[model samples]
Target chain A: MKPIIEITDLYFSYDNKNLAINNLNLIIYEKEWVAILGHNGSGKSTLAKLLIGLLEPLRGTIKVNDKILSQETVYDIRRETGIVFQNPDNQFVGSTVADDIAFGMENQQISREEMKKRIDKYIKKVRMEAYLQHEPHLLSGGQKQRVAIAGALAMDTKVLVFDEATSMLDPQGREDINTLIQELKNDGDKTIISITHDIKEAMLADRVVVMKEGTVVATGKPTEILKDETLMKDCGLDVPLTVKLSQELKKYNIINDIYVNQEDLVKSLWEYSLIK
Target chain B: MGIQFDKVNYLYARGTSQEKAALIDIDLNIDLNDFIAIIGHTGSGKSTLIQHMNAILQPTSGVVKILDKTIIGGRKNRDINIVRKRVGLVFQFPEYQLFEETVEKDIMFGPLNFGVTKEESAIKAREALKWVGLDQDLLQRSPLNLSGGQMRRVAIAGILAMEPDVLVLDEPIAGLDPQGQKEMMEMFYNLHVNQQKTIILVTHDMNYVAQYANRIIVLNEGRIGFDGNTWDLFANYELIKKYHLDLPDITKLIIDIENKLGIELDHKINTVENLAQALVQALGGANHVR
Candidate 1:
């Protein structure tokens, strides 16, 4: 439960008049998967930028691995953090998947032999070893994202952020990425932050932080945060379908408690059905 | 006027080794005022099919009749602009294409390009703004300075200003939040219901298809795999699996509950409310539960 990323009294504004991140405070523990939910212009992306040293905060501090983010330590901070963005077409820098992955490690002054070995190991980890030589343009959106995740993992960063990563993908592609995230969580070694609009994606997180008007409105377990329809609406999100069903059943006294996951809810309903 | 596509075949990089067929033997008859949802996997020729609606990409070996215009493959056609003006195709993430300094100017740009008078285009701009549920005060603001959701609405307003008969939206709500997605979908649905505008939407979200679209057209590998009512499309579990399509979340939940509880629930229920009612009835009636 060691804090890996700590933000204190963070403030940032793009226009110098309106605050994008207003007095925000948060701490992400090591090996924790936190999903940040917010509507557009709620400053989710700004926070992601500030964390990896892409944008300097106007006030307060962001500490990654206990090192405060500043001009001098920005490079050191960035080396330990990696981010995969929304658009897959814009993130490619190499002619092939293998080269794109090696590009990051090479910047760290890793030797050719070690770089090759790490690339091979991480590519297989993300399940993209078969498409090692495929061009970026030839790969599907889901495949490109897998490669991106592979690239980030290849860097051996402690903190990995996905900024609306699966938003642009198809359902199957999204499933693949979500599965990869689950596997990464099971490994319990890297801290993952997913900023997404999909409630199903947030349901997979260890913690959920809901933002509205550039500030944290609610923070708790995904089941607790997502079950409150009012808070979800305030943050411009819809409750997941399973939760809605459970709530309705609860009102009719058909079920005693609300369930977030599909399987558990269905199981509860099945047990209830056997009553009569 | 409706659109008619006849055995259309489109090939990219034609006559080269790199040439690939993007659309093949496509025949579709889209009536006026039809709300159709086009769906399939990525790279399933959905984009290529919609691009033909506005002559953005003409077919290689077939005929396309849009409104009063006819485009024949391998033949000279000079009315591409006329077809484009009548069938407005909004690309995915269309906000990225917004470059005008002001929102008003951006919306008017399309109408002005089509030879509308400045005064007339201004009027159209305000009307289009209303259509997309934006305030008139935003007219003077820079399009780039607005939030992502506003920028997207302004981009759609640009298309509406053109007064197109057929509105084709490509993944219009892909990156939007849950509420933004609901708002945009409602806006399109209103345009279809109240304004009598034809909406041909391309989306990966079957939830929207189940809720809004009356008709569904599924494409697979540059060909039409299924074309029919939404109910008929979702009824076949095998077809849905074969196309790698996902059911609406509510529908999926209902099917899961039926299987887990060993009860027969209606597969046509697409909303949470209806699903709850059905579940209660299946699990020994609401009266019995009470």
Candidate 2:
């Protein structure tokens, strides 16, 4: 399968003194939910910006969908990609939820009728249909992020980047967005890249890329990466609670398998207990 | 004495078409040296409740007594700065409030505002910087030039420099990386421990509430849903769910294990280590494991 997005030898710096992304190389395939996990200054967000042409790489190249990203092709690249940032208030440009969802479509000069159709479709996708007329300020942080996701989807972008989009939300809100992401992934075809420090969120992804100091430290399946305690610690991340509990129980010879979810872990424990 | 709120009711744009009640019949008593965690859904009056601690927002129909000062509703309180100085609030995303050119100047601003001497305020700023774990060299640099985490530390230090007896934090660790969040929580934990200061934290993370706070308060739709000890808060899962709150992961795991296995397990496990031990014991102890 062709890689949906290919980044090679990517180097970027905010100032000449510090390289925000240093000699990073990454490949994301079609319909893959890739989670980029790292600490605050680990260049994960910088990679997101570089992917959408918000920040230009000092060296190397980024290719999206077989086309090399350049100054001339940047707008086209952005049209194919949409990003939701950390703060919901900063990204909201419209007064109402419907207006916000329609803002991106209006920018593309989409017709009013077409815009209405996309807005209705995507707003329902994020489960914010009841809040179609609600203003941005009145909505909860999670609802605002849902509206932001709707706005992104209304653009019909194939590749969506969520840059710590759930960081500011409450636990319930985080769960809501995560469930929405799962639904989107189940629908398939779109490439999703989430840049976050949330271990549980990363555990749901198809691939987890751990970063450190602007470089890729490890990239593997979520289960594989999360099991490497030394690596997770080096990258300044906490292992998921279920994984940690499983490991601890394994030390006492109670549960042999490393489980990432609660139900499976409990089932394994029950089986072990019955055997004893 | 710390702070008390009696029948507090706060209305946004009161007596107008847009009037909305933010807090309804809030009666809370926060004792000195208390570590209290407030849990609620977004727009559940957490922010509005904490603002009353430092007189940032006065109640529409209540009496707020901070230390010895009494602020009555429907009356202008001219001496509220005394209450503000006694309760230092670290607002959410406080880094955005950093406006001073240098980090040191910004830290000193709060103490200086409260009538501390220039030299004393500088001393307090240095002490505050140390408390937040920032290096002394960064004091001269522009606060805007610092990293996001560092800027947050500086903002927190600005509040600490005020030497308030009570610290009210509104989601201070929001938007921080995992390591940053841990470090910030630890810093506050130390402050609560060593300084013996009252900590009133409004947060959405149940894990932090279970681990740190001795007392937990839940709010729902501008009303106090539940207020009790951390242990009771976790055990009251039904009430927790009703208020749109969740049990911490460790507690949830234990509950799940019990439900799946059709066996009763203790739900008092607050930490991962405790949960691991409890699971092993529930499976008939370590010796029984083949």
Query: What are the per-residue Cα lDDT tens digits for candidate 1 across B113-154?
Result: 999999999999999999999999999999998878889999
Residues A1-276 of candidate 2 have per-residue lDDT tens digits of 669999999899999888999999889999999999999999988898989998899999999988889999998888889999999889988888899889988889999999999998998999899999989988888989999999999999889999999999988789999999999899996899999999889989999999999989899998888878889888898877888888888889887788866677888987876787
lDDT winner: 1
Model 1 stretches with alpha carbons more than 4 Å out: B287-290
Superposed on all Cα atoms, model 1 deviates from the true structure by an RMSD in Å of: 1.4
Q: How many pairs of residues collide in each model?
A: 0, 0
TM-score, candidate 1, is 0.98
Q: What count of clashes does model 1 give?
A: 0
Candidate 1 fraction of reference contacts recovered: 0.83
Clash-forming residue pairs, model 2: none
Off by over 4 Å in 2: B287-289
Worst 10 residues of 1 chain B by lDDT: B281-290
Error of 1 at B212 (Å): 0.4
